[model samples]
Target: MKVTKDIGVWTGTWLLLWSTLAYIDFFGIGGISLDTYFFILSFIVVFITCYLIAKAFYRTPLQKTNIVNYKFIKILFVIVTCIYIPILYKSLVLMTNGNIWEYRAKAFGSNDEASILFGNQNLRILYTIFIEGGVYFIQFAFLSLYLLTGKKSYLFKGFVLIFVMSIVMLGRSPIYYYALLVIFTIIYRSNGKLSLKVPILASILACVLFFLSAYRAGGEITLSYFIDKYIVGYHLYGFSLFEKSGGANSFFATSSWFGQATLGSFSYLLLYPFSKILSINFLYFNSQEYLLKNSFIVLNNGDEANAFYTIFYDMYQDFSWGAPLIYGSIFGIVYGIVYKKAMLRKDLNSFMLMLFFLNVTFGMIFRNPLATNGFVGFFFYFLLYILFNKIMKKRLHV
Candidate 1:
């Protein structure tokens, strides 16, 4: 079904509001304090850009389709397998570098490690890219094709394989798995509409489970914590007083809290550049010095390591206002294009596009948008899709 004018308006307005809030929360009103106003303007620019792009692509003529063939699929599979070998080998080699893992671990804990790792003038940024990038693009390729082709069995098998691999390689982050399931469910639901009753029940269950998990995790609770920490606490809440809270009260109180908030924030930020523009400086860059110093004190005071927050804090200190908006916008545009293109394919559905969008969004939020690993993965995936279609057409004599 074609996207209606109402849907377009709704999407644009939602994106604009969310983006503005997030950008403000992240970057704060710093020196010169143009952030808030700049963010508003940026939101308008982004919305118009995206709307125009969508309209153009949707209205453009679609390329003729080619018939599929087993031989073509096999050839494409072989090519993909070959390309993966080197990527896999390089990733493994980098994994052996203890410093990378140690820094990654430290970065996870709320330290300056992530900033140090990325900030080191001599550090090979490509290595960082290779280590964290490829998984999502791989996911996009498999899912997009399955959606386009309407091959449930193939999609199911691919999901299982990718899911298992992610768990094995990335460690235990339920958010990643849960995200995949959410996207798949959304996509599978006919016409992207979940029954209101089912969604309401699911939302209730999710809230209950979240509280149960938090309670089990154990922490002091307050009104600010509930609003800032729990309410807008997800990644999208942007920079607020809750983020200003220091010590154990900071949002990154624990790994689980950090994971949940980060995922939520990342999802919205990457999808909406205006949000990133507003929040990036304050949340990720400018706040680093404080985060590192505070986290260091907390460490001395018997707090568990908050290395990841520290790394984020350090990033703010290093890059200031420039890093978040510039990087975030570029990444958002790229991913938006991918999502738009994926949607154009007859085989894919909104569900698959949502999944791909989420993965891309997360990467852009936490890591540099231009990280090598993500770039290579995305490039290969898109290239493979184009090649696969070409080979299928040639074989079928279309």
Candidate 2:
């Protein structure tokens, strides 16, 4: 496949647009704060690393025989899905029994728990590990299968696995499924462009179906949530603009803008170690009091903080200046390897690249790795690689 100059331009443009959006989302529009600087620097590092990987894809020659077989990928996916079933079942049990949120709070060392009810230390630890580990492995299997098998059936199966795991572990959030749908459509589309009529009609159908699903799920599907929570709360107040009190909205509060700004910039470097240490200290030593007392801003809903600002702030609280450099370097190296390998194959496709991009955006940049299900990240990348090889072979006429 010949590398088009347009592809390069599109890649560069996407990076620029998303990075800017991310920066604004993280730091607001107050120019370069400590967080902003760290974020930009880390992003640049990751961007360069990914760019090299994409370049390698453009340069590498195609292969004749399959690198891996579809049967193997399918078996792997099945094994992973089976492994997740128990964990999912356990989470369902906990959620249904009304201990899900309580368990999360206690696991995180929240001082709100007056007494320890579940004294099965081993079981508790196992459950924690299972939930975390299961999600990561499930993601890996799903992504790997998608990459290895170009079959849309496998891709849909991957999405279903991810969706089930996410719902079980994280509760019902439509975002994951929506993201999967968008990615799948992008991957399956013959080209990026859609005829005006086709795209519009498809989009309308998607919206209608989304609402129908939500309605069937017993939740009132209102446009207000998207407008308020995701759009204004997340996109507007959460990024680029400040609230009247220089705080985040109810659904998305952060520490001081300065604190968040300082921490967010270097978050790529700070997030991992911070998560590791906090997880240990909170889980083992019962250190919730310190965090709560020292918190710059206490959110009414801590789960929101988990997805929004907790990771960045926690890192800053833990490792100050050293966080960004160490974390950024490690993340950059891993991303570099993935990108390099992908580029070398010359099989990188939009779907594969988009998955990588979203993983970095949602997992690495916006949320804490520890707080998230690592399997989702692993699954997305692996699936992309598998799908890239499968789909590119057909699309590129290799």
Candidate 3:
């Protein structure tokens, strides 16, 4: 069942999914207006065009190594769980005794609010690194093991950890992330083969998300409610950003747009985990001011909140007209190169690294995954894998 290593199809499909969803405006939150349609269509064309061009230059990786050692991975998993279990217990206690919903609200409310949720900044930092970051790395590794060995246990173990972490955090994004990773791993395992089961699995995950959202709200939520609030609301919020900012004209005319378009966003994307302590002023951009002013989530209860502007929302804010042509093309080229090494050459490390890029790709409907701390986790784990390979190779003289 070997298949073509064509990531363009995968990337294009996700783009179409979100764009089509935006077009449908299913619950009539806000249909894609003419300007939004033009922007969406243009971005898709540029992204796919650049992806195809880079894909044309594909070459097989020169060095493929057998990095998935069962014994080593088993030991690593045991060690990570041991380190995490105590922290997990503490988080569970906090969720039960504390105003967990308020905590969740704070986590999403603002950076200042989120920074102090765990009683002190240090504990919050530890919680983010070991729990939020750790779960992703562990699940990614376990899923990789599952693909290599065809053992369902590894997949189950990863899901359990992610599930617990999601509950403790009182959020649904982790579940979405794990589900996306599962889809990616399965596709890679099947040599790019796809089946009807993919959509079925996605539907099942959507159901799970619906339930999780209801649980978080402490009430029964309807399908239409979930669709309008959770699903359609984010895209609508994104559209509002485009409209409020005056679309592409904001790039040249707006001073605030300069902050979003600068290298500051990339610095935040890659080094967010360290930026708090480092205090590098030049690398930081206060796009938060623009987001707060432009993107506000209208709650069902008539309250307003923020966050979850669509993937291109930030890019559009940053580069406007150049978002698709420049940022889109850059992403397409990089992704095309990685897909070749990971899928075609069967390079384990590259395959794992590709998962992070895949996260960014799939997250086009949501926000940029690279802008989250999970990218730090993925990069950290990728390095760990490389280090382990070197140590193992030295020991085995491979």
Candidate 4:
């Protein structure tokens, strides 16, 4: 409706940025030796897919008023706070053979790689349920509700909630989510005319935070070190570094569990929230295929690491070598439709959906698609939205 950018536009742009980095990293970037034809080809496919999505669907955010029941938001906030505050307190109070920081570092840190795999699975699972589980629930819901309410008090409370969640898992994702929400909200308040400087600065700060978190366990902290480690998020060197490891071509040349990865993950979303509530593992939606591949990725690298691959790698797990091109185009079509429908309707639900998609997109290919992980979060918000909408007696002013 206006001459400006929107969420989908920004998301598609992110795709382009990551893909470009992939190309530079895969090829000889400033005399680096990580060049590979397959890597470049993978990035090409992703860039083109992003182009298609942008061309076909990106639009300015619809300028409209959205009304929600203040009562509903308050109740939602109270419920979220009651659940998480206690967990945060427990994480601070209890100890699993040591403090919270040591627990996290050993369980998942590079310093003690096998900590999670070896530590008391029962205690670890409990820690995950209480502390980490609340990240998505309270953070997004509280912040989104605050954005809807536009109250300074609500905003401050939302920040506190995020702080509590970060105490447990202050990894890249919680930080990224917080930054994106703040930036997106700021851009929204600016009527879609936000200067590029704000986001650019925010990005630098986020990266610094990411690097600082990684180095908090006592290691080198420098610009060059950050660039060498976390800033280079993807495994661009890939399995090709190992002699017997299968390269990208070898991956596609062989068969894989296509549906079990793609549709199976989609199916797994249905039960994930329940399993979390029941204190049971979600089994990554029962797709052991990723686990098997993760082992290979570790072997190929000769390290003790989880097989958290890039988006292309996840798609490969689903559809083999064709993952980068055809599957990416498919995502373009799917997300394009979501973008079109949501923008036309001024639907916050749709906006949240795309935000989660971008979350995983920029998040790299370490976990299940956002459609599953983020969808579960969105599904809860959707229920809340419906309840609020039905209870409202009259339309409220923004």
Model 3, position 377: C-alpha lDDT score: 54
Which has the higher lDDT value, candidate number 2 or candidate number 3?
A: 3
Per-residue lDDT for 244-356 in model 3, tens only?
44554443434335333333334555455565568654233454534454456554334354555555666666666666677767877887777767656665566665766
Better of 3 and 4 by lDDT: 3
Candidate 2 overall Cα lDDT vs. reference?
A: 0.42
Model 4 residue 344 lDDT score = 67
The TM-score-based order of candidates, best leading, equals: 3, 4, 2, 1
Residue pairs in collision within model 3:
none
Which model scores highest in TM-score? 3
Error of 1 at 311 (Å): 15
Residues 230-344, candidate 4, lDDT per residue (tens digit)? 5453333332221123335454524465544554334565566787799886444445544454463333223333444444444555566666666656666666666565456
Each candidate: RMSD to true structure?
11.7, 9.4, 4.0, 6.8
TM-score each candidate. Answer: 0.47, 0.53, 0.82, 0.66
State the lDDT of candidate 2 residue by residue for 218-286, as single tens digits: 456677654444433442222221121231212223321223233332332335467587764322112
**Native RMSD of candidate 1 (Å):** 11.7
Report lDDT (CA) for all predictions: 0.40, 0.42, 0.64, 0.51
Give the runs in model 2 whose Cα sits over 4 Å from its true position: 1-73, 79-149, 170-221, 231-307, 310-333, 346-358, 370-373, 376-398
By descending lDDT, how would the candidates be arranged? 3, 4, 2, 1
Candidate 1, 8-77: lDDT as tens digits: 3433454455445654544232111234335334534554566456545543234433335334444545
